[model samples]
Every structure is written in structure tokens, then in C-alpha cells.
Target chain A: MNASTSQDRFCEELTALLPRLRRFARGLARDPADADDLCQQTVERALKSRQSWQDGTRLDAWVYRIMRNQWIDEVRARTRRSQTFTHEEEGANIGAPGDLAAENLVELGNVGRALARLPEEQREAVILVLVEGFAYKEAAEIIGVPQGTLTSRLGRGREALLRELGEIA
Target chain B: MTVSDDEFTAYVDGELTGAEAQRVAAAIAGDPALASRLEAQQRLRALLRGHLDPVAVEPVPESLTQMIAAAAAEDAERDMTDTKQHEPARVLDFAAARARRDDQVRAARPPRLTLPRWWGTGAAIAASLVLGLFFGMRVADDGASVTSGGALVASGMLAKGLDEKLASANEPGKLRILTSFRREDGNYCRVYDAGASSGIACKDAQGWILQRTVANGAPERGAYRQAGSAAGELMAAAQTMAIGEPLDAAQERAARREKWNK
Candidate 1:
């Protein structure tokens, strides 16, 4: 395909990946608005640098990596400005009322708060492997870590989440 | 021998293969503690997935889609520039060349009001009333209709344009209809943008009541940013008002034909 056609096709495919990317971002960022912003930044960056993306590799992985790096950059920038990344009030307001019962909603809220409490590294690993369904190797590649590191993070993350959800003592 | 936490995690994740996975399974079968731990891990994973997977299927926000479209348009423009650099030029008559240049300039410029015939009486009265009530005598030239009290208010052509036009018509400089949806109260609301400003208006007896308008700095004439900070209020308004998924093109067409009746 010609350059423009290829880019158009790439964007079309990228659009299909948006929800998954946004979910991953939600795991990484503390608030829904921030996560959406991160997702938008990743998409914009990915489109601007489409020439650099290889044609055959997993586009989802590539986009995930972009989101990961974007989040890191945002955190660094926020740190330099001495601003807090997690907005407790904003994060609290982020949850929309769903079709679930009040008890299930509370449970979901607990799970969300628990997920948000995990260390950033552990959260990243859990989201990639457990949520996004990435293999250890694929998740590691997206997070720029070794397979062993990813596995360890997932293990620790699982334990923490289990404890928080009262699934374990 | 006990299976390590990493091994258990790997097995649960379906990453273990052959003898490794078999060995873990056998260990779990033999050791009750290991079995319980494995069960806990599995449960936790499942529970997290259950709680979070909904986000993945949540309706993709319109602002994000607009952002992606804007980026793609920028990419296309860059591609056009690159192609122009490599292509051969064609000679044309002076008038034709000038006309082509004018068209290009016009395309680059933001949408301007063409003053449709109905504007003379209808829009003129609405515009004067809204402007006088909101901005008093001296209106701001920021392309945003706002009140003297520093609130965004839609009036005149902007309000009328959003009411009468279908997004499919694709008029330049006109209010671009971003999306439409019915509110919980059964009123129809639309997200719209002019050259620079964007807001949400819900139809009522008063005619396209301006629910909320945002006056961020004007984006470049033809270049709209979907996720601009200016849209934050409008987005929040849309999120709060939208009862369900915004209507698709066909639904939007039908709604327009019905003159946005409930």
C-alpha cells in the first residue's frame, strides 16, 4: 500500500484497539479523565510517528508501549511540577453508576480502589497480563521489563489484590 | 517440592508448558495449601477481570474519536505536502490558477457565515436579542457567544445553525455537529462547534437552549482539536446528559428529518 493508504489503514486498525488501550490506561492512570487523556496522547503520538511503526508486528503491543511511555512521561512531568498524579477526589468521582446491584457496585468500587493502591509497576504488570490478556513475554516487552520481573510483579500484585478484596486473610 | 509463587502465577496465566505445568498441577493435587493458594490467585484474577473488563467495552468517547480524526487529517496534510514536493507542476491559465489558489485559501480558512436567506428576519432577531441580553452592547470578537456575566451562551446564527443543519451536510465554518443523543427527560441534545467555540445545546420550547458553552482560545481556523482543554466542560455536560449511545448517521438523519421531535 502507498504511504497514505497504509497510514489510513493503520489508523483504522488503531481505532479498533482504542477500548483495550483505554482500559489499560485506566489501570495505569488514577482517574478516568486522566486515563482518557493518556489514551488520546498515545493515539496522537502513534499517528504522528506512524512512519516508524513496523507493518507486521502486533499493533496493540506497539500502542500499549506508546501509552506506557506516555504515562511515564506524564508522571515525570507532574513530579517535576510537584503535582500529585492521583487525584483522590477526581478518582472517586470517576466511577459511573452501572447496571450492577448496590452491593456489586460497592465490590467493584473496592476492587478499583484496591487496584489503584498497588505500586505502579505491579499495576502495570497486572493490567497487561491479567486484564489485557497479554502473555508474560508480551507483557514484559510492553512494559520494558524482563519476563522474570513481570512474573514477580504479577505475583505480588495478585497477592495484594486478593488481600484487598478479602479473598485472602 | 513446593511450586514457587512465580511458578504458580505462570501456571495460572497459562504460560507454563509441558512438564512445568504438569508438575505444578501434580503439586497442587498433592498439597492442600498450594491448591488453596492457586485457587485464591485464580479467583483474584477472575474478579479483577470481571470488575475492569467493562471499561474496555464502554462506549469510546467522541472526543477521543475526534482527536484521532484530527491527527489523521494532520497526517494527510503532511502526506500531501510531501507528494507536492515530488510531483511535476502543470501550467494553467492565469485566471484558473488564481481561482485554484482562491479555492485553496478558502479551504484553509475556517467556516464563515454565508447569511442564509432566513437569517434576515429569524436569525437577526434571535441574534440581537441574545447578544443584547448576554453581551450588552459590545460583544467580544473571540468567535464565542458569551454573556456579560462571563458565561457561554449560544444565540443568533450559531444556535439556528445547530438547530437546522445536519452534520452530513458538511458546511464549512458552520457549527459541526459532533454527536446527538436523547436526554433522560426525552429531550434531544447535540454537541456542536463553530470555528473556535464548542458547546452542548438541548432542544426545549425556547429553541436550542444553550446548556453550556466553552470559550477556550480559538484553535487554528480549519484545525480543530478534539481534546482541547476548552472542551472539558462541554464533555462533562455531554456525559451527564447522554442517556445512551449517541445516534449513528442513519438515526441522526431520521431525527433531523423529524425536526428533532421527541
Candidate 2:
């Protein structure tokens, strides 16, 4: 069919996937506002270039991939523009031992902080395999890595998270 | 028998086949250390899933559905606009309409594309058409019309300015057009364009609203060759434009509620 018609169809499909896409963005972004902004950006990009979308292909993966790329770009931009600062130095400290027992909320907060600290590759593997429930192969394809690579990243990510959360043996 | 990390991970993922899987299971059953490791892995997996799975399987949001429908309508308008500008004599094709609908669904979920490999070829053809239209329209006098020389000249500085300027305030060598309109929610949404780059910017009561930037040469190349390969990138950008469902007459009225500050 003609280009315009195809693009029209693409917009329809992309609109349908927004909620899931927003959720994925939220997971990656952590902050609701950032996630929503990212989701909006993802949708905007997908709609504008709907013609680039392959017919009969999964729009979720395509959108996720775009979100992933956008997230990475943001992180890179943040890193480039900002000065290096530790969590504590940045006013993100979770506090010490005496404060720990009373801090279930803080502990959960720590989980998010630790998750954020994991390497981007590892975090992606964890998000895809553990959160998204994608099969190993599917996760690998989405991340553009080998299945073995994804498995390894997931393993390392989990191990690191466990250590950070004080759950590791 | 003892299971290594790989064995345990595989077992947890249910990847081991036949005797090997059985072997891992038996090891986990009999060996405390192995079983403990398995438990730990399982717990970690569970926690991760607990946090993330909900996001994947969550009920699709209504806003998203509205956005998708509105996007579809917007694409139809864009198509109509293009057709009017480029091929006014031709009648709209019904098969093309159905195909466009199907294409929308397909483009919405790109991961599903791999399962049916045969559909890929058709997707590629459709993708080429989409990109061709986008680029063709970029060059053509309709739908965000851009003169070739004007676009090329605008590319160098505008692209950089949009990339750098986050706020609506004017910066050196930056062209910002701002318009305020009430959104469906009665909140204002703004739109802007960075003149140097072929990027559109919108803003509302909130600061810089939305910025959609496209590098000029890429569209030019795709337009001339009608290359299907470039369709993926083109489709991605198109989706970005799908942000606020195309401004409806009512929404446009709402949008006019606030004056845009460029």
C-alpha cells in the first residue's frame, strides 16, 4: 500500500502499546515524571517515522528498543554534563546500622538505588529477562546481544543486586 | 552431583534438556549447598519479577489507547495531506486502508515481528513506502513543507541549538516558535520548531513542550532512493511525533487558550 496509509496503521499500533511502553519506561527511568516524558518521546518518535516500521513486525520490541536507546542517551548526557559524585555525596545516602531497623521504606528505597547502580547492560538484561519475562533468546535479540551474553549479564546483575541489598551469602 | 552457576541458571530458566535437567534437579534435591544456591537464585529472580513483571503485563492504559487512535487519525490526515499535495488525482485505495491498519498494529509491537519471518518482507515494502512518503513530503511543498536549500541551510545550526537549548527562552543562534493550546485535560500544551534544524518544538503552560528533530540529509536520501532499509529509522521518528494525538479541532481550540512564547 501507499506510504501514508501504512503510516496511519503504524500510529494505531503504536498508540495501543503506550501503557506497556510507559511501564517499561517507568522501570527504566525510576521516576514517574521522567518515565512519562520518556514514554511520550518514544511515542512521538514512533509516530513521526511510522513509515520506517516494518509491516507485521512486533511494535513492542521496536518501541522498547527506541526507549532503551533514548534512556541510554539520557544517561550518557547526564554523565557527560555532571560532576562525579558518590551516592552519599549526592545526598542519596541510606544511612548507617542504627538507622537500618526502622527503615523498611528506606530499605526499599535502597533496592531502587542499587538497581540504578548496576551497569546499564546488566540492568537491561535483568529488566528484560526478569521483569519483562522475555525468553532468554528473545531478551538477547531485543538487547542485540548473544543469548549467552544476556544470561551472563543477568547473572552478574542479580549477583550484584543481591550483594548491594545485603542478600548475598 | 553438584551444579555450577551455569547449570543452576539454566535449571532455573528451565533451559536444560532431558538427562542434564534431571541431573541438575537431582543435585538440587540432594545437596544442601546446591539447593541453597538455587533458592537464592530463585528468590532473586522472584524479586526482580515482582518488581518488573507487573509493568510488562499491566493493563494497557486508556491514555495510550487514545494516543494510538489519535495517532492513526493523524496519520490519515498526514496521508491525505500528502496525497492532496502530490497525487490529488488518485482515489484512496480501500485495500491500502486495511493494510495501513494492520501495519499500525505491526509497528506498535516490533518484538512480535520475528515470530513470523515471512511477514518481514511485506513489512519491508510497507516501511519503504512510509519512509518515501515522509521524505517526499519533507521535500515537497506540503505538510511541514521545507525548501531543499532552506532545509539544508537550516540543518547545521538548528540541529545543534535544539540539541542544546532545553528551555523556551531564546538563545544565541536559536529560532524558537512557541504556541500554547489547551490540552484535552484543560492543561496547556505548547509546540515549537527550531528553525536551523528541521525540528518542531511545542510548549504549553509547562516549559518546553515537545521537540521532534530530524537530520535533513537522511530524509533527502531516503526520498530519492525509496530505500526500504531506511524505513525502520523513519518509522521510529514518526512514532515520536505521535505524542499528543494530532490536535483535533476541539483540542486546537483548547490549545489556543494560552499564548505560545517562542
| Model number with the top DockQ | 1
Judged by DockQ cut-offs, is candidate 2 incorrect, acceptable, medium or high? acceptable
Model 2 lDDT, full chain set: 0.56
lDDT of 2 by residue, A78-163 (tens): 65444344354553343321122343335436556666667778888888777666778877887788898999998898889888
| Residue A12 lDDT, candidate 1, scale 0-100 | 79
- Per-candidate Cα lDDT values, in order, are 0.67, 0.56
Q: Each candidate's root-mean-square deviation in Å? A: 20.0, 20.2
Q: Lowest lDDT 10-mer window, candidate 1 chain B?
A: B113-122
Cα shift from native, residue B109, model 2 (Å): 47
The all-Cα superposition gives candidate 1 an RMSD in Å to the true structure of 20.0
Predicted candidate 1 versus true structure: per-residue lDDT over B124-236, tens digit per residue: 22223222222222222565544223333457987777667664454555456655778999888886756445677877666677677665343343223222333434544
TM-score of each: 0.51, 0.49
What is the TM-score, restricted to chain A, for candidate 2? 0.74
**Lowest lDDT block of 10, candidate 1 chain A:** A93-102
